[model samples]
Each structure stands twice: as C-alpha cells, then as structure tokens.
Target: MRQQQPAPQAATGTTAGLANAGSKKARPSVWKEYVKTRYLFLLLAPVLIWYAIFAYGPIYGIQLAFKQYQIMDGISGSPWVGFDNFKYLFEASPDFWKVLSNTLRLSLYHIVFGFPAPIILALLFNEIRFNAFKRITQTLTYLPHFLSWVVLSGILFIILSPSTGVVNFLMQKVGIEPIYFLGNGHYFRFTLVVSSIWKEVGWGTIIYLAALASIDPQQYEAAIMDGASRWKQTLHITLPGLLPAIAIMFILRIGGILDAGFDQVLNLYTPGVYSVADIIDTYVYRMGLTQMQFSLTTAVGLFKNVIAFALVLMTNFFVKRAGQEGLL
Candidate 1:
C-alpha cells in the first residue's frame, strides 16, 4: 500500500501552493479599491492640485533667504550670500531689537488677557437659559470677526477721535480729559489688545461652546444632586472638561507669539505710536517689500518661522508632559 506513495516534500509543496492561491483570490488590489472610490477621488483632485501649486510650489523660493536676489538675475541666477542677511538683522539693524521686543510683549499681553476672554464669554453664554437673547449676543460678538481691520480701524478713529469721538464725549461728561487712545504710545498697545479681544472673542467662544456641549449632562445632574452650586460645578467639572480644548488652543497661540496681529497693527498704528505698536511682521513688511531689502526680509521671515516652529514644539511637549492633549 505504501509503494509508489508521493514524496513528503511533494505533498507539502502542493498544500502550500493551494493555500497561496486561496490568499491571492481573497486579497483585493489597492488599485481596484481606489477605482471603486473614484467619485471621492475626483472630488478631492482639485484640492490636492491647489495645494501642490500654491503651497508646496513656493518652497523652492525659500532659497532666496541665502541669496542676493536680483530682479534681472532671478532666483536661480542670484548669487548666494549665505548668512549675511541674518547676521545683519541681529547685529546691524537697530530697529530689530525694538521690533522684536514689541512683538514679544504684545504677544504676552494677548496671551494673558485675550486667551481667557473667549473661555469666560463661552461660560457666560452657557449660563444664559434664554435662547433668543443668547443667540443675539453671540451673533453680535461674532460679527466683528468678519470685519476687515481697515474698516474697524476707521470705526475706532471715529469712536476715539479727540474732538468728535463718542468716547471722548463720554469722558468729558465724566470730567476726565480727552485721551488719544490710538495716537498715544502708552495707550496704543492696550487699544490693540482690547480691540483684538473684542473682535475675536465671539468666534473663539464658538469652539469652547462646542466643547462644553459635548460634556455629559449626567455629570452636571449628579453634581447638582450632591448639593454643588453653579460656581462649584463650573470650577470642578466644566473647567476640567475644557482642559483638552484649552491645551490645543494654547499650543497654537504659543506658535503665534511673534506675529502680534500685523493687519490690525498696520491699520491702527501711527508714527506717534510706532514704539508701542511696531512688531516683527510690520517691520518685515517695511524692510522687505517696501524697502526692497529682499534678502534681509527673507532672512527675517526665516528666523521668525524657525522660532515659531521651536515654540510650537516646546509648548506641545510641555502640554503633553502635563497630561493634556496637544495640537500635534
């Protein structure tokens, strides 16, 4: 009976071949899967193309930071200047330190005052049981966010005008002297912060409100059953629930510590308030685009980007180390 039996190796090979054939038949090809979702792919193609052309395409021009860029020579033919532009910025440019200081100080002021404003507004909005009133308040607050800084700055001029301004009129009635809010160096930074918060707080609160809505109603009910007051519930439950969202926003804000609202500052600032209102971005604009110090502007921009990137990384690390969620 054992005579002429197939060799053991031959039997094993046959079984292995059958198993591989089954797998080949079962597995779906990636290309086939893509073809199956071709409609989605078609819809996504334009966005992918847009990013490729606008966002990634400009990366090649970053080399201008190290080159003596000439309009005739163009980017490719421009002579390389290495780190001279950056060295000049740090050592040679007298305004660099002052602009840098203003940027940092303004950013710090925003973080201290601006960051908490939205959260507080959101919390206040959440406490309002009257839906109609709440909605109207939210709409009023968020409307400012859509306005161009040019328009807002014009409005500010009208409201803060020394002679005809509504604010000055009110101050005169209260026996206080008419103070030039925008023109005065001492008041310019404060006006920037207040105006920024006023414009953005409503929009920012929308995010926090969304986060608040996601917190379990049962937790609040249970807390009330345990005899907790509204303040206690907010302090213990609401704030803790908001920590994840707060951490994410904080990390993003840290990345913008060098920005200091270029549009707002540009539109609102004057020669009288330049010491307080000038920032890295405005300085870069005046130096690079206006003054045509192309290489130096590029270097300043590069330096700003590097510092921002480092700040984001460091901030994310600290946030995660503190057991909170981060943007990354």
Candidate 2:
C-alpha cells in the first residue's frame, strides 16, 4: 500500500461504475419477466373485452338521464334538461309512490321469510340419512329454478285458476271460498314472495350446503364426546360456521333490495294487482318501452343503481366492523 496503491480514486470509481451497470442490466430483465406473463393476460382478455363492450359501453347512455332524448338527435345530440327527468319521476308521477311501496313491501317480506328458508332446508338436508332420497328431493326442488318465469307464471295461472284449479278444488273440500291468488291486489305480493321462495330456495341451499361441507367432522365428534346434544352442536359449531356465508349473502340481498323479481312480477301480474305488484323495474320498463319516455326511464335506472351501490358499500362496512367476511 505504501509503494504502489493503484490510486484509491480508481478503486472507488470502478465500484461505482459496476453498481450503475448492474442496475441498468437488471431493469430490462425485470421488464422481460413482466412480458413473459402475456399468456396469462390473453386468458383474461375476453372477460376484459366483454366488460368493455357490454358493461362499461352501455354506461355512456346514462347521460340520457339529464337530456330530453329525441329520435332525431340521439343521446349525445339531445337537448340537456337539467334534472327534468328526475323531477317528473318524483313530482309528476303518482305511480311512483305506489310502485315504490310495493317494491319495499315485497323485498321486506322476502327478507323476513324467504331468506332463512334455504338455510333451514340445507340444515334439514344435512340430517337426512338416505343419500338417494336426499338427492331426489334436491333435484325436484332445483328443477323449478331452471324454468323460465314465463313458464312458471303460466303454470301458476292454471294452478291458481278459481274455476278449475287444484287449489280451489282443495279449498272447496274444506268449505272455504276460492281465493283469487293472481287477480287480487291483496294477495299479489304474498303470492310473489311465496313463489319466489319456492323457486329459489333450492338453488340458494347449494351455497349453504357447500359451507356445511367445510365444517370439520372432528368438531362434531368432540362435541358428541362432551355430551353435547345435536341441537347444541348445531347452534354452536354449525351455525357459527355458517354465519360468514349468511352474512355475505345478506349483504348481496341488501344490495338488490329494489330488485323484487321484475320478470316474475311482470309475467304474473295483471292490471288488477298493479297497485300492489308494480315495482321499480317493471315501472321503468313500462315508461321506457311502452310510454316511450327514454329520459325518465334512464334517470330512474340510474337512481336505482346508485342506491344499490351505496347499500352494498354500507352493508359491507358494517359486516367488516362486526368482524365478519365482507364483499370487498
């Protein structure tokens, strides 16, 4: 070192240059690593394209909510009316209150009675010892879900027909008057909820069944060894395990509180039950297609979507705060 140290400056410069050169080389390799995932991206390309074309593409039409849409001008060229559509829906339409009330009542009834039915069915199915019987019952119940609302409505119409219906025949044997299930305003919402529950309960039970399947068998054995009753085990282990699934489903249901089964209602309802059966979706459909009020329909749809988005967010917030699995 005393004789001929090449020069401390040269040594430091070489180290610095090598470090810089290494980083420069590393950057391209990192980029190449990213580019190598092109096949994975190609797999997702169709879904991305679908959303762009169908989901996000249609969102551009939302601007019609603020405009007075004309056939000649179309969406972009239509004259801006500045909330006139919303004003009309809120102030001018008397059907607004009736339809909204019907929608809320139907949804509330479904939540109260319909929501728990699948859980109950799932629990009951879990207790069945005969595998073949269980499979047959499940198949029969789920078959109705595959039927279109139009077909189901037609079937219901015949079954509930006062003149020759099986239901009326049974009622007559019991000395009770034949009730007009489809024609009466008072029974429309009730029938709708019942029919919906009957059609959907089986399909809904699939999720709960999956959740039940995931429960550790060892826990049940331990509970049995501890002298825990069947009901006690269900209440403690089964129900608690199912709670996360239930919470997630509940949040999804709340998100679509305004839905109220539009296709079923539209197919089953007549003018006689319009006051109690007409929901937001059916009303929007009537306004848009039948009445040709495109702007009002768009505004109503936008309002419904916004409300749904907010409801989902709020429900998810509460779920997370309560230490449950959330949609996020």
Candidate 3:
C-alpha cells in the first residue's frame, strides 16, 4: 500500500504545532526593561511633563483660531467663525501683509548673511594652531549669547545713539554723518540682522566645530603627504565632510523662516522703526495682547506654523534629490 496515511487527528495536531512554533516569537520582558533603564526614565520624566503641560496641552486651544474667542466664554464655548479670521488676515488687513513681507525679508537676509558666518568661523578655528588663542577668541564671541536681549538692547541703544555715542563719535572724527542706526527703517533692519549674527554666530560655530571634530584626522595627514595645499584640503575634504551638517542646519533654519527672533526684535525695535522692524511675532504681540484681537493673532500664528511645516518638508525633499542626505 502507499505509505500509511497519518491519522486525521495526528495530522491536525502536527499542523497546529508547526503553526504555533512559526507564529510565536520570544518577547523581551517589559519589567526587565523597566528595571534596567528605570533611572534614565526618571531623568526624562520632567522633560516629558513640561512638554505635555506647556507645549502639547496648549494645542487644544488651537481651535481658538477658528472661533471668536471670548474671555467670559472659554475656547469650547466660543462661537466658531470658521475662515473669517484667515480672510481678515489675507484679504482685509493691510498691516498683516506688511508684517509678513518684513518677516520674510529679514529671514531671507538672515539665511544669506548669518548662515555662512558660523561655518566660516568654524573653518578658521579649525585652521588655528594656537589652541589658547582659539579658545579665548571663541569664549569672547560666545559671551554675547549669554546676555539677555533686554540688556543687549540697552547697550545697542547707547552704541547706536545719534549723539553722545561711541559710534557717532568715531563717525564724526572720520567726517561721516552720525547715522541714526536704530531710528531709520533701513538702518534698523541692518542693525537687526548684524546684531542677530553677533549674538548667535558663536553658538552656531560651536555646533559646526563639534561636527568638524568627528571628521577623520587621517584624511588631513594623507592630504599633507600628497602635498595638497590647505585650501585644496579644505575644498576636497573639510567642506565635503561638513556638507551633511550644513544641509541639516540649513533645513532647520528654513523651517523657522517666520520666527525671525521675537525677543531680539521686540527689545531693540522702536515705534520709529516699526515699518521695517516689525515682524510677524511682534505684530502678533501687538494685535493679540495690545489690541485684544486674540482669534486673529491665533489664526496668523497657525498660518505661519503651517507654512513653516510645509517649507521644512519641501526643503528636505529638495535636499535629498540633490544627492545628499536630508534632515529627515
């Protein structure tokens, strides 16, 4: 006869056994994981709680953008106005457009002038053979980052004053006009960009310098052995090594195109220079807090964040298509 057929029950049991063995996977113990990393979790708990309370918790109030917010009636109780707020921003208000333009111009100026400063500084620092001098210079540059905008603004006011200021005094000696750097709109914008660079460039340099440290030292040694000049080495090796970090920072910077330094602008800007200096953040501050137009300001804020989000995605996509790794 043919090979004896297994009993139907035996075959079923064998099939079930195979299925169970194949489908079942050994899972690591959750309790063991908790026991092993309990301290790390404890350290992270505060950050999670703060983000939950301050960042994500307020997200529920985003509906305020859609509603005509009333103090007596809360976010949920407020009557929904739908797209009216957005219409007011894009169609009705002239001021909104002005602020939007200012924000974009300032942000673009920042990317053009400010973005490269750190990279250049880091490269120069890398070339420095004198460690002590490099450290001292780096420390001096970084000190401005620690100062608050309020204090810095006061210092700026003194330095930029048309009369009785060091800058004006020096200009007078050179037979140049005592330009009101803080009062005139164009000069104010220039001051804002330059001051912003001064305050943050050092910190940004630290980031690029850290990125530089990870580069292989052997490449430089080999380049020296090959008789490559310093410029040639930087061009072929250093910059190529920095490309990934540069691309990452560029994407992040593009995403915040609307943010344009709220604290710095607010502190340094005056009513005289509002035409050029007022950015989206300061405009929102005036409209929301000063004019009590909460819903409109919220709508504007929401719009800005959406545009920023889209920009980030688009930038990352382009960056990847250019044959380099992207932020994502």
Candidate 4:
C-alpha cells in the first residue's frame, strides 16, 4: 500500500539489479588496465627480466650462508651447519674486527666529506646565471663520473706515480720529496676518500640540481621584497626546499654503510695497503673466492646486511621524528 510495493518479484528484481551494480563497482579492472597500458608494459618487460635474472635470481643461493658449501655436493646438497659459520665469523675470524673497523671508517669518511660536496657544487652552480658557462662547467665535472673504476684507478696511479707522475714532478719543483700516494699506508685512506669525491661528486649533484629546479621563484622574489640578500634567500628558502631530497638521499646512504664503494676500493687497493684499504666487500672477496672459505664469507656478508638494514630503519625513524620526510 505504501510507495508502490508492487509484487514481491518486482522488489526482488530491483534488489538483484542493485546488487549487480554494486558487484560491478567492486570488481577491479585489472585486465582493462593491462590492455590500456600494454605499450608501457612492453617497455618495462626488459627491466623486469633483468631484475629476475640478475637480482632476484640469486636469492635462492642465500641459503649457502647457513650451509657448508661443497662444489661436488652443490648448493642444494650441501650439509647445513646451522650457526657454525656465524660462530666462526664472530669468535674465530682473526681480522673480522679490523676489517669491520676499516669498512666503517671508510664509509664515514665518504659520508662526511663526500656527501656535502655535491650539495655545495649544486648551490654554486645554481647561482651561475650564464647558461653556457654553467653547462660547460657541469659537463667537465661530470666526465670523470662516467669513467670506470679501472680506468680511474689507472689514471690515479699514473698521476700519483712518485718517479714520473706530474704530481710528484710538481712536488719536486716545490723542494718536497715525491710521495707514493697509492702505496704508502699513511696516505692511502686519504687518497681513497679524495679520489672517490672527485669521481662521484658531479653525478651526485644532478639530484640536488633537480631538487633546486622545482623550488618556487616567488619565494625568492618575496624574500627580495623583504630586503633579503641572495645568501639569505638561499639559506631560508632554497635549503628548506631541498631538505626533503637531502633526507631521502641521506637515508639511502646510510643503508649502504657497509658497502664502502666496492668497485673503487677493489680497483685501487693493493696488498701493501690491505690493512687500511680492505673493506667488507674486499674481505669477502678474499675469503670466499681467493681463499675458498665460502661459508665463512657468506656469514660475514649476512651479518653486514642485517646491520645495514637496522641502520636504514633507525635512520628513517630519527629523520621522521625530526619533522622531515624520510625514505620509509
């Protein structure tokens, strides 16, 4: 009797129709998305394949860390030794602490000296009004970044050679003795840090420059209207704008605290400087490959990864608590 209660069948039909409509809304258009972005998917196929082959594929072998790996027995057939490998790492390994200390010190040196370099370069470059000159300077700085560590190490050797190198030649002109930078343990760490900065600072600046580009021009103009100088504007506006990017990069750098520039260190290091030069990666290489202590080295690697992961989490937590955005 009320508003058209009609037949029970009619009401059921209306309810069914509403249910169908609700069902349609709830259903995801996953297939439709694939069809619409099929070209983009095709473009991404190679990268997916690359990760599958080179990155994710090796995860299966991580079990080797817990097992006594035998070449004849293979990874799967290797007998599990449980925590023995890890025990060896902590209790028995002679140079474990030394290597760990070297790794941390090198990483700290890179972060302390290397991290701010690109930011400084970016700031200086941003102030340059001449586009052509800025581009030339940027290009010159960036060229070294593209060079391989092998090539760069060779270049360093040639330049720092005590007898024939130009650096030593200049030292002689200044009435100073030619110093073997790469060979002498006293200067090896210093050389490593400085060379690393030279090779990487230019490339690292690209991120900061990109961050700088997105900063609002109006902020600078407003600052100018308020009698702010360029220095004041940069200090107040530019750095604040760049803080998010800096925080993110810093978090990432902390995640790699154990890495310590493997390629650069490996290429530049010699037996003479191994005490100071040997990092986690080189130590693992020597133990695992050179000495055939696979299980021991794998345990060391696992320990490093755990610490790095913890550092990343801790860093992100502090960064977020400080009222800045973090990588998490």
For all predicted structures, in order, the TM-scores are 0.91, 0.89, 0.91, 0.91
lDDT of 3 by residue, 246-326 (tens): 999999999999999999999988889988988999999999998999999999989999999999999999999987799
Give the per-residue lDDT of model 2 (tens digit) for 171-200. Answer: 999999999999998788888989999999
Candidate 3 ranges with C-alpha deviation above 4 Å: 1-27
Question: Which runs in model 4 stand beyond 4 Å of their true positions?
Answer: 1-28
Per-residue lDDT tens digits for candidate 1, residues 1-328, read: 5579898999999999999999999999999999999999999999999999998898888898999999999999999989988888899999999999999999999999999999999999999999999999999999999999999999999999999999999999999999999999988899999999999999999889999999999999999999999999999999999999999999999998999999999999999998888899999899888889888888888899899999999999999999998877
Q: Rank by lDDT, descending? A: 1, 2, 3, 4
Note the Cα lDDT for every prediction shown: 0.94, 0.93, 0.93, 0.92
Pairwise lDDT winner, candidates 2 and 4: 2
Candidate 1 vs. true structure, TM-score:
0.91
Error of 2 at 75 (Å): 0.8
Off by over 4 Å in 1: 1-31
Compared with the true structure, the alpha-carbon lDDT of candidate 4 equals: 0.92
Q: Candidate 4 on 169-284: residue-level lDDT in tens?
A: 99999999989899988999999999999998999999999999999999998999999999899899999989999999999999999989889989988889999988889989
Q: Give the per-residue Cα lDDT of candidate 3 at 119.
A: 100
State each model's C-alpha RMSD to the native.
4.0, 4.7, 4.5, 3.9
